[model samples]
Target chain A: MAAEQGIDPIHQFRIEPIIPIHIGGLDLSFTNSSLFMVIVLGLACALMILGTSGNALVPGKIQSAAEMSYEFVGNMIKQTAGTEGMRFFPFVFALFMFVIFSNIVGLVPYSFAVTSQIVVTFALAILVIAVVIIYGVMRHGTHFLKLFVPSGVSPLLLPFIVLIEVISFVARPISLSVRLFANMLAGHITLKVFGAFVASLLGAGAFAVIAPLPLAMTVILTGFELLVAVLQAYVFAILTCVYLNDAIHPGH
Target chain B: MATTETAGTEAPGAPHEAAFPPFDPGTFSSTLVWLALTFGALYFIMKRVALPRVEGILQTRGDKIRGDLGAAFKMREEANQAAAAYEKTLAEAKAGSQALAQETRTRVKTEQDAKRKALESELNEKLMTAETLIADKKASAMASVGQIANEAASAIVQHITGKPADMTAIAAAIAAAKV
Candidate 1:
């Protein structure tokens, strides 16, 4: 019961560098966040390789899981971005697997959550938006700006509508990154707070009998957080696809 | 006591630092670098290895299914053709058997008519012989009946006269009586 003097819930989010490396006066040191990322990459790659290694017509469990994940992302892209969008299937699949793996791996006790950090999520969102903008311009030329202009609008309100559209368009990456970060951050914090409550109660001697309440709550919250973890990743990937759809099709 | 001391030492360090380290800009560059590196690596793996293998497996499975369905359809058509051929042969056999039965029936009828005609002619010949024999028998019986009548008439004449009747007279009387 180290919770005798209360617990610091924010301590879990701290970035402590594992290997300190400096280049050109910049701290490019590998941190706990980076370590977890490497672990996720290894796990993701291992799952795909081992699962598909057999490539049996009648699939084993691992192969089934691997194929199911492949179809899931493939279908998501096909539905949101159409068949033409399948060209980006690898990128979207990577983003989805990385986010989901990062979120799930973070659920392990004492593990650092990569997605909980704003910088990591923001970088991903920016990558998606940057691809969308670059490809939209290349494919659709100047007509890509039509994304801001609504069809069948009165000339009187056209400028106003365009302005609103532009603002929302610019806000895409911010909202995309923030939504994932906030959900993961909030869920983990709530879980920690409840865990600390249980610990504090257990340390209170006579009040120890009621410790099961917060403990039960923490267990339930953990289950809920797991769902949120997978769901937030899906949301991020789906929004990326939708944004890419605008790039490919523009306007409508 | 240890937890309290650690918490106290950490509480005085930052008055204006953001409550969440994620909001702190100090580690942004490093986080970005790692994200780019890991994501790029994962993307490369997905593109190079994982997806193509899965896609190949799916394509093979799809082709197998289509091939099986096509083979099944072809087999069904072959079965249908075989059944049709069997039915046609059955019908042809039935018609051949029917024609053979009809020919046999007509031949048998003609043979029976010829035999009946020959048998009727033979019976007619036998009936004619029987009629001739009956006519001969009737003539002999008539001759016997005439002789018996003459003898009885002569005996009765002799008894009444109490003398022998003359041959010539008797003969003449018998002849006149016969006439």
Candidate 2:
């Protein structure tokens, strides 16, 4: 346990560059994170492209998956954001696929989780907010500022309510980013810790008897992580739709 | 583990950030770049190729189902029309046959009545001739019976008297007896 660096739960998130490319003071090097991002990209696109390649009227398993994913995102957008919010369907679908694929691909024994990085989640969250802001302002002009003001609040408490609303509005990206990052980071760390516990127990002499306990815990956590992975992706997509809804129809 | 070892061997950028990777600002640029590249590519592929194909498949399936329903409905309607025509033809033929049977019945009845009338008239004519012959026979028989009586009376009287007796008396007696 003293010398095992593999057991360091935080070590798995380390980003070592596979291809170091430096351009204009930016470390645009492709790291393990980037590799896995590409992997996620490949996985997601492959599922979509290959699954639909046959274009079968009666879909095969893979084709059903592809169709289900499309309808899943499509219906999500329609239900949360309404038909008008369909303009952002491509973006929302992309985000959902990326996150879900990243989560799933990361579950591989030695793979790095791209979403565990806060910067990555923050970037995606920022993108959603940026769309909301840019399109909201462009479409509704000053009326978009009405998003901060409640329609039915008494004028006496309006200032406080508006302040709270502004804070909440500003916190959306932070909350959105942190929510996903924290969940992935915590879940992975727990998995790593428990896995190390099992390994450590197996390496121990008499304590090896209880190795099944941690192993079982790891197995259960893995299952839970799979759920979290999918649930988080759903949460991400649905929230994106809700935000896009504001962009399409501002206020109230 | 290979990745972690590789990270350790890489030029240690900073001691502080190296302890925890998520907080490291050093990898932000690369992460962001990759996110943008990958997400942009996904969006592009989905929008341009995959989604549209799926949408097209669903649309085609829907159209095919609707077409099948329409064709079935059309066939059913045609069947109904044919059945109706069959029923009409059957009713028409039934009515025509019934009318024909009625005509045959009336014609046969008329012919039978005419033949019976003819037979009855012939029988009546034969009966009238027979009656007239019987009447003539009776009258002749009556005249013959009177002659036989007159002879029998003359023979008896001649035998008893033993004489040719009085012709005038005899003639007068015979006349009174005839009366």
Per-prediction TM-score of chain B? 0.66, 0.63
i-RMSD per candidate, Å: 8.8, 6.1
Candidate 2 segments exceeding 4 Å error: A1-4, B1-17, B119-179
**Alpha-carbon deviation at A53 in model 1, angstroms:** 2.3
Instruction: List A-chain TM-scores for all predictions.
Output: 0.97, 0.97
The parts of candidate 1 lying over 4 Å away from their true place are A1-6, B1-19, B24-26, B130-179
Q: Candidate 1's C-alpha lDDT?
A: 0.84
Model 1 clashing residue pairs (backbone) = none
B60-88, model 2: which lDDT tens digit per residue?
98999999999999999999999999999
Q: Clash pairs of candidate 2?
A: none
Error of 1 at A229 (Å): 1.3
